[model samples]
Every structure is written in C-alpha cells, then in structure tokens.
Target: MWLPGNTGVYLPQDDTALLIDAMLLAPIPRGARVLDIGTGSGALARAAADCGAAEVTALDVSWRALAAAFVNTRLSGRRVRLRHGDIRKCLPGRHFDVVLANPPYVPCGRGAPGRHSPARAWDAGPDGRAVLDPLCDRAPGLLSPKGMMLMVHSTLCDPEKTLVRLRDGGLKAAVVARARCPFGPVMSSRADWLERAGLIEPGQRDEELVVIRADRTR
Candidate 1:
C-alpha cells in the first residue's frame, strides 16, 4: 500500500508486513475494537479496519506519522482514529479487543534517534528494548478480557523477554509467527556497531522478526 511520505513518518516494511499477516490470521471477532500503537503509516490500522473491525484507533508519537496515517486512512476509506502522543499516556481507561504494535527495535549505540531524524522509527536503545519493555508492561492493562495483543520486533531484542513480561502481567503469550528478513538500510548501516556491541554475529546481515501473540484469558 502506497502512503504519502513525511519528514519523520516511518514507511511500511517487512516488520509491518509480518504483523499484518499475523493480524489477518488472528481470531479477531467481527466488529471488534482494535488499537494500533506506534502506528507509523497506519498500515496496521487500515488492515484491521479491512478485517472488519468496528472501531480502529491508531497512536503515534510523531506528528508527521499521525498526519500520514490520517491521509492514508481517509484515502483508503477507513475510519481510523489517529492520535499523536505517547502510547503510554494517551487514551487512559480504554481497552480494546485487539492491540497491535510494531515499534522501534533496532539496536542503536546512541540510543533513540534524534528529534528530527527519520531514524526514530527504527532506532531503539542499545538493548533494543526501549519501546518493547514499556509496551509489554502496558499490554495487559490495555486489553479487555479475552482480548489479544500482537506485537512485532526483532529477535535481537529478545522475544523471550517479551513473552515473559506479558506472562508476568497475566497474559498467555507465545511466538505465533516469524520471518527471516535481510537487514534493511538502518540495520545495514549499524551492522558494525551491532557486532561490536555483541548483539549480532560478525558478517551477519539478516535478522529474524517475530510476532508475539498475547491473550488475556479470563
């Protein structure tokens, strides 16, 4: 799906496609409420809406991303609520039947990307858990009983950690899908730092992306 480009908005890539595949296979009921966190180009939001979700809300910290999403959603003729804010702060006391996230997961020596860099879309802290940890912590609270959360990230960040965190938060979690994709431009450029940091093996040029599914089973 082609979307309008913005200064800092992230374009849909392999990780986004992986999450969309998982979402399509998920057992989300018709007319379910869905939330997409860190919704860059609103691809997931639009996908959920196409899957017959009654309500779809997408949140992102980047204003550029929100604007792009708004345009994309409207162009697709889907009613997705786009909000610009931190996922942890906005929309309190609200829960959804499905929550999806494809957050920043690339290991970066300088931590998060600078304010104006498009790198903000993929550069996570050294351990690559900057956004993953927080998202796991908030998943249970944001999901309704019997709801499910599908999140995608690189294995470099430790998919087990995500499963453990969600399980500790009272959700049954497991890896439902995975894809081995060649390193994108961001990861390709940071290959040296990642190897030096012992996050990736020498000469490794691909990363495995995993989609973790966590269900709030009452």
Candidate 2:
C-alpha cells in the first residue's frame, strides 16, 4: 500500500526494508519471543516470524499503522500481537528474547511539520538521540537474560554517541551495517543535521545511514 509523502508505511520500499529483515534474521533464534518496536511497516515483525519467533509483539503509537500491520501480518500467514500507544509508557510487562526497533534518528527541528508526522519517527531530539535514549534505557529491564536488541539508526545521530548511550544502558552496542545514499527529503541532509547538532565540522561531507546491532550484556 502507498503511505504517501512523509507517512512511514507499514511496508516501505522493498530493498531497504528487505535488508533490515535480513539483518534481523541472522541473530534471532527460532521460537524466541520477540518485540518489534515502532513497527512502521510491520516488516520487521513479519521478519521475526520468518526467523521462527514463536510470538511477535509489534508496538506503535499510530492506530492507523497498527491496522495496517494487522492486515499485513495476516497476508503473510503469520500472527502478531499488535498494540497502539506510545511505547514508553504502555509496553507489555513481559520480557522478550529480542527487541528490535527502527526509531527516528534524525534530530528534531530539521524541517518536520509537526509532532505527529512520520517525520517524528525519524527525528530524534535536538541531538538526534531523543527517542532512542528511552528505548535503550528501558531495554535492560524489558529484555530476557541472553536476549538481544537490534536497531536501525543513522550516522546523523552520532553512532558513537548512540553506542555510548546503549553501553551506559548496559547493552554492548556496535555498528553492524552502514550505507551512504543520496539524501532524502525526510529531513535535513545528514550533513546539515549533523552540523546543526555540532556533530561534525562545517564543509565536511560524506553523510551516511546505519543499522546498529547490539546485544544485552550478559
């Protein structure tokens, strides 16, 4: 289905989403309980199914997106426990073997129209780690022992800073994948956002997006 300009789809372009799917597949074990946070396109939740996750819980703040995830999961012949709410407050109390998220990594005020826009999904706080901060903070309590948490982030968010945050939160984090592409309109170009956040020197270029794969400290 078409999600229109700036609305994060429950299913986005096949190539990028598929790559995320593959990334998630390798580490998740069969029949493990999994949580897919901000399941924009339900692509990652569905991937969890393919990975043999026994139960998948897909959470998002958008009722509209949850409806789409329900439909998409059915079409794939899989079932997911879907919830609609700000994940920060209403997360299920149970822990999971894995928690995967692709939170908004772009910093706020980078030309987003408002709070509810899909831009919200990509726009972090002033420094581009706002949304991710909470997720990592809560992960220690939410994850099962021996569990893993994988996220797709961007260099715009300062991969090192994110690593620091996750590490401080007790997850051993690392950059597992990265790719540089022509800038998209979703926000300021990575360079501009990075500069605005003081993450890079002026005139320095070569911006990139990244997917970080992190494991909970044993």
The candidate scoring highest on lDDT is 1
* Per-residue alpha-carbon lDDT of candidate 1 for residues 1-218, written as tens digits (9 for 90 to 100): 45645445788999999999998888668999999999988899999999999999999888888888898889899999888788768788999999999998888888566676788788788899988998899998999999999999999999999999999999999999999999988899989999999999999999999999999997
The local lDDT score (0 to 100) that residue 92 gets in candidate 1 is 88
lDDT of each: 0.90, 0.72
Per-residue error (Å), model 2, residue 18: 7.4
After aligning candidate 2 to the native by TM-score, how far in Å is the CA of 16 from where it should be? 5.0
Question: What TM-score goes with each of the models?
Answer: 0.96, 0.82
User: How accurate locally is residue 208 in candidate 1, as Cα lDDT from 0 to 100?
Assistant: 97
lDDT of 2: 0.72
**Residue 46, model 2: Cα distance from true site in angstroms:** 0.9
- Write model 2 residue lDDT over 47-161, tens digit each, in one string: 8897789999999887767777787788889899998877678766778898888876666654544645655556677777778778777777778888887777667677787
Colliding pairs, model 1: none
The reply for model 1, stretches above 4 Å from the true place, is 4-7
